[model samples]
Each structure stands twice: as C-alpha cells, then as structure tokens.
Target: NNKKGSNLYDYWGTDISDVLNQDESDLIVNLASNEYFKAIDKKTLKANVLNIVFKEKKGETYEVIGIYAKRARGLMVNYIIRNRLTSKELLKDFSDEGYRFNQKLSTGSSWVYLRG
Candidate 1:
C-alpha cells in the first residue's frame, strides 16, 4: 500500500473528482459501501467527507487528529495526490517539530500519517 502514487481511487475505488463534484448529502447517502464506509459514526463520516470536498474553502491547515486507514486514504488524495506532492516533500513539510509519521501502525497501513 505504500507504493508510490497510490491514492483513494486505488484503495477504495472512489474517484476523488467524482466525490468532489457531488452534492454533500447525496454523497453521504450513496457512499455506504460496507467494506469502506461501514462502522464509521455518521457525524464523523459526514465531517470527513465534507472536509475532503471543501478543503480549499476552509483556507487553513488543521491537523488530522485520528484518521483510520480507510479515512486516511481520502486525505492522502486531497493533501498529497491532488497537490502533487512527492513523499519526500511530504516528509519535509510535516516531519519533525512534533509531527511524526506513522508512529505505531502496521506496515501495510504505514503510508498514512498524522500531521499533528
């Protein structure tokens, strides 16, 4: 899963553009895949999905507090893939200074990291 260029589309079969273009409520109702979207609390799910769709509008950077692997894929797509940042660049920007990368996750899920 740490293969370079891997993204939400690769992990969840979800196209970021499609998710971004859809209405928020419509996305919430349609994105009910048990393998990925299941088991997430509704409020958190909505917030995460909306964050992906409207990230630019927020105009501020906030740390991803506690994202699971499935949720983290979307964020990787938003903050990494969409912005065309290489892994090295990501490390340069977010590593050290109290930000750690994949501190305690299994290898298979280590590609995702927390900013704070």
Candidate 2:
C-alpha cells in the first residue's frame, strides 16, 4: 500500500499525461496494479485506458487468485514482448500458461480472461 497520505498524481501526473497525449493511439492498456497506476491522473490523460481483469472460474463463481493472477499478468507481458503485438485483436491470441480470452464476459474497455 502507498505510504500514508502519499498520492501518485501529485508526483507524476503531468509526465503520465504527456505520455498519453503523444502521437500514438490514444489508448493505454493499463496492466499496472490498482495502487501503482493510480499515480496518473485520468482527467489529464488524453488516451483511453483499457483495463483487463483475469479470473478463475470456481463453482458458480469467478475469482482472482492473487499469486496466479500476478503470473498471468507477467505471461501476458511476455507474450506482448515476444510477439510485438500492437493490435488489440492480437490479445485474443494469448494462450500462454493456459489462460484464454473470454469474449462473452468482456466489455468495451475492460477485457476479461479466464482459466479453469
């Protein structure tokens, strides 16, 4: 957790905003954990940030197991680096470590992946 009364936006909001506003697709695929990425002030960013959630299906429910979820996030980063994937569509091709994209459970900005 962040130190008491410490806020990310107060430290690096402008830098993050500038990066997002640069001449790239106005999309930010936020893979950072909730605590760390909060350093960026969303209002200042011109990019549309896409957040992905990973889950495991348990009987009648879906849940994120912390350790496995961390592994899954790393695997996804590995896949991106290895494949040089730029298009969001390529994200659907991710199957490393047994996770699969779940289209039926995804929304416009948030994508979900599941493994069971």
Candidate 3:
C-alpha cells in the first residue's frame, strides 16, 4: 500500500510546475487559495507572480473576510476571462462587485483590492 497526504499541492505539484514553466509568458496572476497555490515552488517557476488580495473597509480599519474575498476573486477571474486582459495594467480597470485597486496599499508584486 502507498500513502500520501490529501493536499492537492503535495500530490500535483510537479504537474503545476511543469505547466507554468512551459508558458513563455512569465506573468502569473495568483488568485488561488494559499494551500492550492503552494503546490508550485516559486523558485522553480519561470514566471513572476502577482498575488491579489481582497479586503473590506470597516470604518477606520480594513479586514479580510474569507468568504467575501473568495467571491470577489471569482468575480475578478470572470472579468479577466471575459475582457481578455493582456497586461497587468488592465487590472486597475477592475471595478466590479464594488472593488477597486488601492494603489497606496499595493506593492509591486502584491496588489490590494478594497471594497466597502
């Protein structure tokens, strides 16, 4: 008998890594769950990853709600697919589901989206 963890990344890491490496485009939009995204070893990937994070504004503070963030992520994927985004610059035009890019809160590799 053989045994392995039930983690998707642990099981399919090589496949994921292969696909990413095959792509000539080195731009990766990582909107996946931390667990699933962890399947690919970044050091092995030929692409540069841009992690998108969603947060909700509450008065003077901001918070990350997993469910809402997940929903927003899905919406963003739909938008990207529908619009056929070819560059990271197009990401700033995302204003769906009441979310927009927060430039002040964003970094070069990590983008932050805020919603009320």
Candidate 4:
C-alpha cells in the first residue's frame, strides 16, 4: 500500500518482493489486457503494459525488469523489459513520444495469454 498515493500499488517481480517483503519468494506479476499495449489516446499508454524483454543492468553485474514506457502514439510501442538497474542506459537516449499514430486501429479485443 502506498500511503503517499493513498492507493494500492500494482508493481510486479522480484525486486519489489525482495525490498518490500524481503523473505518472501512469491513473484507478483501485473498482467495487462492485450489492448493495453496498443495505441489509443494520450491516456491509453499510461494504463497498459507495452512490452517486455530481458536486459542487462548498468554499472552492475545483474539484471532488473524495466517498465519505462510511460506513453505513446504510433510506432512508439517499443518498450524494453530489462533489469531495473541497467534500464536507464538503454532508454536514456530514446524519447518516449516518438511513435507515429497507427493508421489501422485495432478494436474488439479478445483474450490471449491467460495467467494466474
């Protein structure tokens, strides 16, 4: 729970689990719907998970999950899923608002990946 934000948090993975619940090995995954990653309005990207990929950490010998795509429009859907520690090195030079608005918008979404 985020007392500052006054709301329940929605972060996933080992880092949060380790620092917040140090002894717990349970992984907290925040699965988003398919449409969440697609282009919509300015507010859409703020509410979805764009993409995920393993990345190396900077100045360290480890890895961390990076969820840095804050918003987008078109080809801007390219997000990196790397170690939280080394994420900045890869995305530091990339702008978050560089995607061209997609011409063919997708609708009527359906369920694909099912997880627990």
Question: Could you say which candidate leads in lDDT?
Answer: 3
Better of 1 and 4 by lDDT: 1
Candidate 3: misplaced stretches above 4 Å? 1-8
Query: lDDT per model, in order?
Result: 0.36, 0.81, 0.87, 0.29
Stronger candidate by TM-score (2 vs 3): 3
TM-score-based ranking: 3, 2, 1, 4
Model 2 lDDT tens row, 3-100? 53356566574786777688578678777776777777787777788887789888988898777878888888888889998888899888887788
| lDDT of candidate model 1 versus the reference | 0.36
lDDT of 4 by residue, 1-116 (tens): 55433422323223333343443323222223224422223231222222322223345542322342222212122443432323323432333433222213311221111111
Put down candidate 3 lDDT per residue, 36-78, tens digits, no spaces: 7888878788889999999999889888888988998899899
**lDDT, model 3, position 114:** 95
Residue 49's C-alpha lDDT in candidate 3?
94
Estimate, for each residue in 42-113, the C-alpha lDDT of model 1 and write its tens digit: 443332232221111122653333334335444445555556763343532433223345434313312334
Model 2 pairs whose backbones collide = none
For the record, the alpha-carbon RMSD of candidate 1 to the native fold, in angstroms, is 15.8
Cα-based RMSD of candidate 3:
1.9
Indicate the worst ten consecutive residues by lDDT in candidate 1: 50-59
Model 4 residue 115 CA deviation (Å) reads 35
**What RMSD, rounded to one decimal, does every model reach?**
15.8, 3.3, 1.9, 17.2
